[model samples]
Target: MDISLWDQLQSMDKPQTTLNNSVDRVSDEAIERYARSKWLRHKVDDYIKDDKFRRKSVEAFHADLQKLSNNDAKSLLHVSNILDNRSLENIGLDSGDYRNLLITYLQSRQDPLSTYRELILYKIHNVLPEEYLGWFKDDLRCSLFLAYLVKDSIFINAYKGREELISVVTDYLRYEIHMFIEEYTQNLPAYKVDYKGVGEHKTVDILYAKSVYLKNRSKEKDLKWLDSSNQHQIDWTYNYLNEEKRSYIILEDIFFPQTKEEKYELIIASLDILSNVEGTDVESLAILKKRKGDTKIISRGNSERIDVIQRMKKAWVQLGTDTKNSKDKLVLNITNKNKEKLVALAKNVNQTPNKFINQAIEDVHREVFKIDG
Candidate 1:
């Protein structure tokens, strides 16, 4: 609902009260007045939780409120929770800037098409698995702002002479928004809570959000909140599994315990959502985020590699392509000293006794792979 006329009026009038005495929040009176409108109620609920529209950003919010005196401003203020103190502080939040933002948000909200567009984009921001956010945020943000600009110029105050131009702007905004949504949040469920009687708050979940997938040249995907399932695996799927469009995938668990379960549920959901896949094939394709100690090893870099091929890469480069700094060893003393392995190597390689013997001595040079300061 485009800030109701009443909401616009209420926004102009700042309630003498504040949110938990910290941020600007909808006052009880305003809540009571607009209680009948479930949409506005939900908007208020979103505002309360929106750290960006947190009480601290109220100064910026207040600028918007100031535009339309106590009544109009109050209504907007009731709905103006667009940012919180943290974002405000981080971005050097000032009432003046927030006032401008209010104008921005309100201008976007004025039209039905733009309002839905903003809401859908907001949903995309929240919906895409957090793992993809860091790589895609700039694209998403720029898409959002550009969409807003197009709407602001072409539709909000549209004129006749620019009909063709408006159509082009409209087409571009539509195409961009569609692409942004498709790239990140596509083929997945909405970022919403269906309320199956579960409540969780991982004050620590945010800490685990930053993630990177190994094995593939793919970029790191930010692991979001701990689902009742695998966030890590969901992240893995986004960066590695999904991109390949692979028919099957195996994900190893990193954060065990709670995250393990969450990762599992998420991968299962993606499997179900991505295709008509079912039964053991679907089940088998997805990696069962296990609790074994080995699962956590994915997060660690080198030092743990033990594959024969991999070992050669790091430990015995001479066996592969790193034979540069080796020294020819001294001749092996074989007159009387008993050597069973040398005898076996000579027989296996089918080389002369002296040649095999010389090779063994050369191997002892222990080729140096790194240079010292």
Candidate 2:
């Protein structure tokens, strides 16, 4: 994948970031006037690159943003595209040139309010957390980052705006913490899956062993990003986890189910592996108990649990079924025997039934609609 706009900025050496304590020092009226002029593009590059300018501009934007009602803030942040066609004409442009082009597009517009709104977006893009910069591709992350900046300040809970912001922020943190926990849990011996070998069975597969070792090494590198001094991020994570008696296992947001029943199925599928851990117990597993009261899932025999859990985790990570993407559900009516075979085949390859079926359909479609190269 191509490096995103914000990720490029984050790669800079000693790009200074500071909280502007006073908004009055940064003049929004003057910015708007300059932005309205045609000559604005000439100064855009210098202003954006200057750390002091960005700090003051961001502070002024922060003040302006809080004054608006929730609906207005939402509207201002809802941009159709980050860069216009003219700005994107040269894909080979370096990060600095790209940033210059984007700011020029934002300020080149005729409507001052529209230009200001675009500029606020530009400011937010500049101030994103460096640790999670790569994950800033979506609007959800952008909104969450903005909320983190201003969440402590007053917002009308009567409008449910504050409540909504907190809910989303918590949900995001839940998934983040869950990944942290996975780093340890995935290394447990009980989590290992018995692979259905192609050629011959062996006591140990050298390649698989090496892969596991490499994976653990990568996890150690990822853990370094988890060490953060940002108080807002630390507080949000601590408060959310503390709210529950036992920590709730939140599915990654992309793969989170739309219905309660699907969520229950996912939790049930994961429990057999979770339960085998040495210190795990009913009191320790809050989400499973809440979703399904049956204690049997926890104590169930490890007959096929490893395969199920592996398949679920792989499918969950592979699928990006966010509501933002348009999709159509296909209902297939098949005989029981065929369905059993399908399920068995999917499990062997560590895929969900839906994903397996979709892949099969796509394979056939590509063959039927073959194009000569």
Best-matching candidate per lDDT: 2
- The most accurate candidate by TM-score is 1
TM-score for each predicted model, relative to the true structure: 0.22, 0.21
Across 1-373, the per-residue lDDT of candidate 1 in tens digits comes to 4464234443554445544543344444443333223344455556645644432433444343344433222223223333221222212243355445545565444332234234333433332222323332333212222223233232343222223233333333322333333332111211111111221221112111111111111112212222334454345443443344543222222111134443333233233222211221323223212221122222223221112113322433343243443344344466544566667779899987678877765665444534333
Model 2 lDDT, residue 260, Cα: 41
Which lDDT value does model 2 have at 5?
33
Global lDDT scores for all candidate models: 0.34, 0.37
- The root-mean-square deviation over C-alpha atoms between each candidate and the true structure, in angstroms, is 18.3, 24.6
Worst 10 residues of 2 by lDDT: 197-206
lDDT of 2 at 370: 100
